[model samples]
Target: MHVLIVGAGMSGVGTGVIAAAAGHTVTLVDRRPTVGGLWSPGGHYPLARLQETADTYRFPGHPFPSSVRDLPTAAELAEYVRSHAARGGLTEAHFRLSTDVRALRRVPPEEGGGWTATLVPVGGGGGGKEQLRADWVVVASGRESGPPTPMPPVKGLDSFRGRILSDRDTFGMGADELLAAAGVARPLDTTKAAAVPDAVGSTFNSGGASGDPPPPSPNSVVIVGYGKTAMDLAMTLSDGGATAHVVASRRHWRMPSTFFGFISSLPVLYSRAATVVMPSWAATTPAARALAGSLWPLSLAIRWLIVAIAYVSVLGRRDLTGPVPTAALDWFRQSFCMIPDGFRRRLAARRIVVHAPDGVATVAGPTSVRLTSGVVLPTTALLWCRGAEHRAGLSFLPAADVEALFAAGDGVRLYRHTVHPDVPRLAFVSAYNTFGFGTAVHLQATWLTEVWAGQLVLPPAAAQRAEVARVGAFKRDILSCNREPASVIMDRFYSFFDELCGDLSVEPVRVGGVAGWLRPLSPDWYAGVGAEARRASLGVTV
Candidate 1:
């Protein structure tokens, strides 16, 4: 089978390598010069919270140097993923680096049973967009592919002399472009394989990370949003001795880097067992009726147990809870902040002031921002780390084909977040899910490969959509508590993993058997996970 996989980052490469090893003809396309979409040294370097071992974040067999720190640096991660991609069964000939996927159109299976993809070379268009055919198309673009939403062009007097920074400016290509834009002589790519052009923080002073070249650091920074990127920027600025103030939209549940002081929260927050507590049939079937009504008492009991465990486990930071609704809880993370390294100390020391449950009301002056609280804070650099818009990633498809691809407005309404109901032979990797990023993408990639290869079969399109819609409703209800709906992450990774493994007649990761089930989901147990997934692909015994 001929397969076209988009994005050379972790998801794309992971999907491509395994599928290619399975004898599927695969082509991995990346617009960037190197791999590691988020971790790439040449792109926006948001710090992915990996409280677990580096093994949790990597593909099976492909891992960071064991000597790398528990909290590996971005350069370390980028290099690790790049080296792994370079070593995969899929060779350099299979990868089209520095290339962008312009659009995708699926050929009716009746016609030829494949999709026609359009590719455009990014920088120099000498390649002129050659069309290619593939039996399957996998969008491994991971999340955060789109450009960050531009900060509201405020009534700022443009005369205010300060660096106008956004996440793109702080952690993305715009960071490199800033130096070039200022005629600061953007650092040349000195190291070919080591230096990532888009992700290189060298000379950018984006942060004093790993002793890279030092770009000028901001003196005072007012950050927007509190996601991974915002926290990273805050840390970088504070490290540089800058006064960092975060204009947080809502207070959120924050856990120490460790869960309950010593427990690794990665397993709990995204692991298979911790993710899906409901019975398998309850998700999309009549069994769910008892979830709210007949089992209302049980539901309350379960919610109480989960919430109480969390409160006790994380030692219950009061800022995360109700009354007036301060910082909101992490919807998918189940209120586990998992942020370590003295974030609380920073808050207490007054170095970082979180003006939360209140957003930036307006840009008061050229160098100041008026909060919804009417407290005006001076700003040297205003960096918005708020997320990017959700893209369907099917913009390249023909309009009619695109219409069938979506049941939810602009989102991919695919079964298991992989194959669409109406659109056969198409799958997506790397949407935000409550699972280890590596494991989640690995499951989807291999499972879809198996499904396409006839090793497993999926449910009917209508049945799949029914379950998806129910889960979507569950996501809405979960976020309705905080009034933010669209982005709620349900703990569906392991549930779906179990289902896919069942279809393929393979064993899911056995959380119960590991360390007497004390740490079932820890990435350390992931050493054998890939072999199991591949075994499922081959219908081999464990």
Candidate 2:
């Protein structure tokens, strides 16, 4: 089978590798000149680091360099991701970078049916246009693909004279350089700024330092969002000498980097045993049924205990409190933030200000922002970290197919978060939002390859749609916060993994006997998953 996988980031590369290993020809395409998606150099904002630890946020077999201790910066992970592709035997011959996939239309049934993709050079180079045909299409181009949702339309925004920047505007710079580029003066005790890398420095500045109008001095920066990006920017800006004021209307529970600043949260949160306490929409597994059916009281006690432990971990940190009370159960359903190291200290020291349950009423003047709470904040740079609007990345599809693929306001209704019940020969990876996304995407790749190769059979379309609707209903009726229509299992990854394994006919539980379940689940445990999948596909008993 010939496979055309769109978006050569982590999802695309992982999918392509699995498909190729399944004895299929795969071509990976992306508009960016490199791989790694959000982790690509210049792809992420300055000073961004992985929210996941180095051990958990990677592909199964490919490990980060020995030197990448703890969480890796965006640049370090990008290099690791690029090497992962090369080591998987994907070279230039299999990639179409700096290219745009304009449209994808299915060939009519009268003729031999397949997918025909229209391609054009990204920057209007010598290549006028091109087309490619593939037996299957995998749109792994993530939902966060297009330009970020523009800043909310607040009153007097146009009249404010100070600089206004989005998360996209600060890509590819060191912390010092980012502060400098934003016209923020460094603290008296700080060291000199490092030279910006040539890749971004050459075209980064449109004015100011290079003979254009000087940028407005950003002495005070008000960041407008409370997601991970907002928290990251708050810490980075505060550490870089600018006072950061965070404005948000709502917030969720944040997991501490470490439990009680001692125990590693990874082993506690990422283990399969942890799923017992998390109420799940997927209650098909034995443990899930046991908890929901016969052991409801036990489950309740354990869940409440988990909530107490998580809540107590951050107790007494007044600066960390949100406008509303957040429970541990809420964290399982909605996406929650992981509190970065030293962030609480920054907030306590008054370097970072939190204005929860408040929004910017207007930009009162060139250097003042009026808040909905009736407070006027002094501001120069207004950094908006509001998350991206989901760009369907399906504009290439016919109108009817597009309508069938997406549910209004909910999200792309994919069965098992991989294939659309109404669509055929098309699958998606990284479509669902979750923690440990790399591991999830890799597993999805393996499962999809087996399914496409006829090694496994999915339920009928009606049944699949019913399951999708069931999960959707669970999210709406039971899950709290209900942030996105696309599923976000949050810390419920273990159950998600189990379901994928059950579908592949492979052992859903990787650990040995009862003792192994206690160990922290690592990506390395599943290193042989693709091989296991291939063997299963060939009907070989292991």
Candidate 3:
């Protein structure tokens, strides 16, 4: 069987390795000259840390170094991915670099039963839109492939006198670009001082000029949105001695990675458990009484415990303390936990100032922004870290099936997150986003390859749908579990992982030693407590 995979990043490469090992002829495609997708150094967030662990990112047998924690740098991850491919005997012939998949259409199956794919080459001239028939087409092109979200038109935006930039344009720029753009320099580096050559040079003709008056450092920067990107940018600017302000419409919950000087990898003891216990307060509907009852108090107690321990153990310890008050816990959650405490302390002291309860109402200029609160902020640049949208690259398919399978709110429509229901020959290697459950792509690829090879038979559609629906119900119940006194979100995170593992027939492993056994058991106990609390608080029952 021949498989065509799009996107050479983690998902594409991971899928290729798994497919090749299964003895299937696979062709992986990506627009970049190298693999690793966002993991590439060229990616804007190249130095970013992984929010998960080594085991979570690597192939089953490819264990990451034990010392690695939090998030691996983009460079580290890229090297890790390349090494995995080589060690697995996966070759470059299997990858089509600098190739973009423009469209996908199905042809009659080669053996007269499955499907063949017609792939159009995007950039190179060699494959003149060749149709390489395949048994399956894996769309691994991730969420970031789409065009950068357009900046909302704001009144007076065109009239701003200062320079403005977007997140995509911030890549690879040095201090000189920053200084010039901010209007701090008297003579900009005309030969090579351009920030975004395409956008800046085309408009200002500044790149080739030998001598040009430097621009003034703008007063401030207005960052739009509040996801990881926004936080990261704010941190970067602060670190670079830039005082930047972030604007967010809502208060975001941040999970710290570790407690005191310890690593936060052990889920049983770490702060992440709080997330699982309480569903995201941001969820709209109320959670099922049973699940909600079990999670809320457990999460509350854990959060309190984390705070208490931090204050007692390291709040004043000079070695433990730095720029920010040292908490006995991982300060920032996600994959960046591996970054040293001193750095976080510095970040804290500098204080990445945040503006909450207010979002951008309009962009008056690149340097000026209006808040929903009616106040106006003067700025130099705007960074959008607005969340991502999921796009299924199945546009070529007839509308009906695409609607049924790829439509939003569709339940586990892809088989084990791989094969499509109606199109069995077509598999989607990386589509879903599982928070913190590392190695999702690897696990997905393994299960997909098995199903493709007839080694694992998936449950019938009805059963699969039933499981998906149950998981959905469970997720809803957990998320809406509480309204006030915010419930822990990590507890529910683990529950979701449990459901995923159960659905995939993968055994959930305890991360820590003897203490780890206690983690799984705590869910049931917490469920009972959460149910009682919900009944008391919301008068709800399940």
Candidate 4:
């Protein structure tokens, strides 16, 4: 089988490696010039680092070099991705870098059933149209693959005169360089704004030059959003000697790096048993459902435990001011983040001001922004970290299938979050965005390759559609906060992996004995998955 995989990020590379191992011809394409999609230095915000430790967020059988830091930075991950691809025998011939997939559609039955992909170089004029055909297509491009979504038009935004920077504009920048580029005074030199080129991209609005001078005080940045990017940006700016004021309408629960001061939360959070109590998209098997039912008390305790940690890390801070709504934990929302270091201490120290349950009513003038609460804050630069708009690239599919790809409320109608019931010979990995996306994609790609290799079979079309509908209903009614068309499964990674493993005819629980329940669920536990999959393909018993 000739497999054409899109995106070239963790999902794309991982999918290609697995498919090739399954004896398929793999070709990977990405719009970015680099191999790592979002993890590439050019693709992410300044100073971005992995939320998962290096050990937990990696491909099967390949580990980050021991010298790499626990939370590898964007550059480090990019380098590691390059090495992983090479080690997996994915050479230059397998990649189409700086390439744009113009269109993808199924070939007519008379012409032999397969997929025809329209490809063009990223920049126009260098290459004419190129046609590539494959027996199967995998849309590994993540839903959130593009730049940060711009904020809605602010009243008086056009008239305001300060520099405006979106998350995208600051890519590959340092704290001081970004501040200087935004026309804000550097920490050491507050009197004069440093020179920077005009806005880097068409989307970035370098707001008109203001007659009013930049703020002399340090910490002149006002960041809009509470996502991980916003938190990390605030800390980075603070470390650069500027105060960062964070503004948001509401707070979201932030998972701590550890329990108390000494315990590591990674192992606990990575296990399937950790989220057994939390309501999830239902288990497909009867036995799994019964086991979940039997663990209701443990689930309740876990919820309380999460709440207690949130208070200790963020909500309980006495020095903080503002009427921020306590983040709802009933459903695991996508915005749930791993709290950064010193976030609580900075909140208590007033270095990072929080103005929550409020919004920017309008840009008051060149040097001030008026909040919905009627509080006017002096601002030298406005940095928007508002999350990106997720899009399922359906223009490539036929119009009829495009409509079929969506369920009620615009949720993607994907069977097992991989293949659509109406679409054949094509699958998507990491299309349903989730926490621990790397880990999720690794397992999903394995399952997908197994199906493509005929080692694992999907249920009948009717049964597949029914399962899709059941999961869609669960999301709309229970996990209402996750409304992305490609639903965000917030902490539901473990259960989702279980579903994929079950389909692959392998044990979902990697460890055994009593320790399996509490021990850290490391990716290493599944290192032998490829061997297991090959055995299954051979019709051999484990």
Candidate 5:
């Protein structure tokens, strides 16, 4: 079996490793010169910006260097992946490096079945575009693009005098070029700047230099977005001694890096406690949805319980993390911040300005921005950290195929965010946002592999479609008032994991009875579960 995996990032490479190990010939294609798509040039650079501990964030078969016991630098992780790909049976021939999968179309059985994908050379070399066909196709192109799909321009953006930067535009430039672009005066001594490895003199990127923003921080930049990237930008700026402001239409939920002071948020996010039925489950049908809104109490209680654990996590800990937040406890339950930095402290100290509910109206001038709340802000760089919509930015698929898959803004019409029942011979890895994404993708790729290899079988198409609808209804019926998308907040990981385990005839990672209930809550706990899944998926000796 020949499998063509797209995007060559963590998701793509992870899938390729497992699939190739299964003895199916696999090809990993990415537009970037390196592995780890989002971390590569196309997305964010200076990979050191991420907050996850490297040991937990990596793929199963590979581990970071022993010296990097804690969080490894971005460059280190990127280097590790390059090494991982080179080490496996996945040789240079297994990769079509620096290539763009321009278009994809399914080959009808009448015309010799399989899928046809068009590839275009992206880098320095000039070569005629080519088409490749494969029995199985995996679109793991996990958001590997520029500045997260440009947002609606601010009213006077074109006339802005100072530099406006995006994630790519900021880190993509060299040290001096970046400083000049952001209109910041260069340090008289070029030693610090010249020695900057990945955006800073120190590879760790600690903002220890004398009153200097790390290489990525723009002087007095205004970031627009409240997601993790926005937090990172703010932290980088604060560390670099730059003034940063955040603009948002609504205040997003913010989580403490540690729920109960010492425990990382990963444990809570992927815990069994979070594996509850969502309110949107009611969205499946009008009649049932009428009662969905009434389930608000249950959702509220769930959110409260999570928050309780958060406060309890830090109950007796030293206040070194930051000032305790007394407001917006609800936001903590909506999303995990994952940033173990002093962002909240910086916010309180006015080092980082947060403009929520007073979103940006547009660029007011070359050196200032105006807000919808009738306030104007002075700044040189306007960094748009806005998020991207998955289906809208999916240009690789033919227009017809995209409409068929993502019509009605319902996102991909895939069951469990993997296989699109309506679309055969295709699967998407890392489509869903979850704390345990790596483990989930591993399971998803295996399910597809087992199904394809005749070791397992998919349910009837109707059953698959019904499952999709059922989940959609669950999301819509979640009896919560948070107004966040119903798709979030619930953890269905074990449900899918168990199903796939049964499909492969492997012992599922079940926390049977009471004691089992407490397990699988910590992020690292998945290591054991993932080991079992990997054992089943790859037939590993472990």
Candidate 6:
């Protein structure tokens, strides 16, 4: 089987590796001159960490190095992936860098039942244009590479005397150029500026002898939106001694990585316990409703007490590994999973004010933002951290294929979140958005590959459609159960893993208490078991 993968970042590279390992000929194409996708410098968040567990985060068949811990930086990840590819004996011939896939069409299959794709390379010493046939095409292009959202036209924005800048331009320029562009004086010396922490130094900085502060315009920076990026920017500014004000459209539910020295222990425990104790049947019962009503206040009280204890213990602690305790897995079950109220209070007290129930109208100027509340904030700069949109380079796909594949209700229609119903041969790997480290992509890719190889057969079309409806309904129920948005990756990771292991009829293994004791070690064992079981179940010769 010949496969074409678009975008060489982690998603693309992972897809290529897995597909090629399955004995399929793979061709990886990307617009960049490199293979790391967003892992490359200038394409990713500078301080981002892998938000999920390490076992779920690692590449297939590669052992994680001993020296690494916590979340790795983008550069480290890039190196890790590059090493994996090299060790696999995958080389330049398997990857076409600086090639852009202009369009996708279904040419009749020359060999068998599957379809073929015509790939057009864009740039680089004029490879001109060549047509290549493939049994499958995987769109692994990442979320961040799409075109930037246009800035809303703000009234009187152009009239501002101060400089304006976009996030992209901020990333592009050197520190000196950035400062000059902002009409701010560059730091004159190392001592004072170095002493002052929390400042994000961009491209412009020159070593100097005399100590002098950069000229201060207005010391206030008004940031729009309050997602993860906004939170990071605000934290950075606060560390740097800048007065940062955040205006949010809605109040966000923040979950700390750890609480009272335990990482996700309490939330994990509560979720599992709820599932075990209150089965779906009982949840809908009238008696259950009465019981829930009577116990609701008590539940809230218990949660608060656990959080209060954890908060008091972590205050003024300096351990960056996190103060959360993980010795007992059930410790995760005791505490509230979201950011403790104590932390929110601390942030509020420190002038990191939240202007929720209101959103930005437009930028009045470099020094002001007009709000929807009819109030104008006097500000120095604006940082927008709104969210991202799913945009596949649609120009490359045929109109019929696009209509069939993309969802009518929400812009993308995925069948079982893998193969397109109309274009069955073209499967997308990393199209779905998850909170952290492309877990869904890896899981979906594995399943798609297995299905294509005839190792795992889907139920009949009628049964498959019914299963999709059931899964979709389950997702909706989970979404309602938790106030947070229904994350495809978070909601489906375990279930997908279970299905891949040929155990869809069984419930997911709950990891709490005794199971929690099994966690740190269990993931590895589970992977091994899953792999062997899948191979055996599919009758694949491995």
Best of the candidates, TM-score: 2
Instruction: Give candidate 1's TM-score.
Output: 0.78
TM-score-best of 2 and 6: 2
Query: Which predicted model would earn the best lDDT?
Result: 2
| Tens-digit lDDT track of model 3 for 154-271 | 5666677655566556554554454445443333222321222211111111112122222223445567755556666555554454545566654433434454556352454333
lDDT of 2 by residue, 1-542 (tens): 89999888888998888788778999988888888777787778877887888878888878889999788988888788788788888888999988888988888767777789998888999588888999889988886675677777889888887778888777776777667755578752223122211111111111111222122235778888888888887778877777777887764567777766678777777766666556777765677788878988887777667667766677634334432344545555566678876666665445666766678888788788888876677776888887665644567776777788765457676788888888777888887677777788889998887777677778888889898888777766555465564556667777678778778777777877765566766787777776786676544211
- Stretches > 4 Å off in candidate 6: 52-56, 60-63, 109-126, 150-219, 236-242, 261-353, 362-366, 392-394, 435-442, 460-466, 469-487, 503-513, 516-523, 529-531, 539-542
User: How well is each residue in 109-186 modelled by candidate 6, as lDDT tens digits?
Assistant: 554644445555554466577676777788788545565445566677676555454544444334344344444343
Query: How many collisions per candidate?
Result: 17, 1, 55, 2, 26, 21
Could you tell me which 10 consecutive residues in candidate 1 have the lowest summed lDDT? 200-209
Model 1 clash count equals 17
lDDT of 6: 0.51
lDDT of 5 by residue, 1-542 (tens): 89999877777877887788777989888877877677665356332345655654665445678887455655666676677667655777888988988888889899877789998999647797899989988988764342255567578777888776666565554444544555655332333222332211111101111232223334676777766777766655644445667776654445566654456675545544444333223233232233336765665567667655655553412111122352223343343445445554554444566665556787776687787876567776777766555665568877876786765354454665678777778888876555555566666777777667665556788888787777655544431322323234234455555555555556554454654444444333333443454455443211
Deviation (Å) of 358 in candidate 4? 1.7
TM-score winner, 2 or 5: 2
TM-score for each predicted model, relative to the true structure: 0.78, 0.89, 0.70, 0.86, 0.78, 0.72
For residue 419, give model 3's deviation from the true position in Å.
4.4
Better of 3 and 4 by lDDT: 4
- Pairwise TM-score winner, candidates 3 and 4: 4
Give lDDT per model, in order: 0.58, 0.73, 0.51, 0.69, 0.59, 0.51
Please tell me which model should have the higher lDDT, number 5 or number 6: 5
List candidate 4 stretches off by more than 4 Å. Answer: 188-219, 284-291, 313-315, 318-335, 392-402, 483-486, 537-542
306-350: candidate 1 lDDT, tens digit per residue? 555556653444333222122223333232345555554444434
List the RMSD of every prediction in angstroms: 8.4, 7.4, 11.8, 7.0, 8.1, 8.9
* Candidate 4 lDDT over residue span 1-542, tens digit each: 89999888888888888778778899998878889988886787777898878887887678899899888988899888888788888999999989988887788888888889999988876788899999889888777665567686789988777778887788878767876865656464322112222111111011211122223353467888877788888776755556677777654455767666657677777666666556678564443475558855665567667666645544343212112243334425343577665565444434456666567889887767887877677777788987665443556666666667764654566887889877887788877756666667778887777676666777779888888888887677666655463466757776787777766777777787757666655777776766786676533211
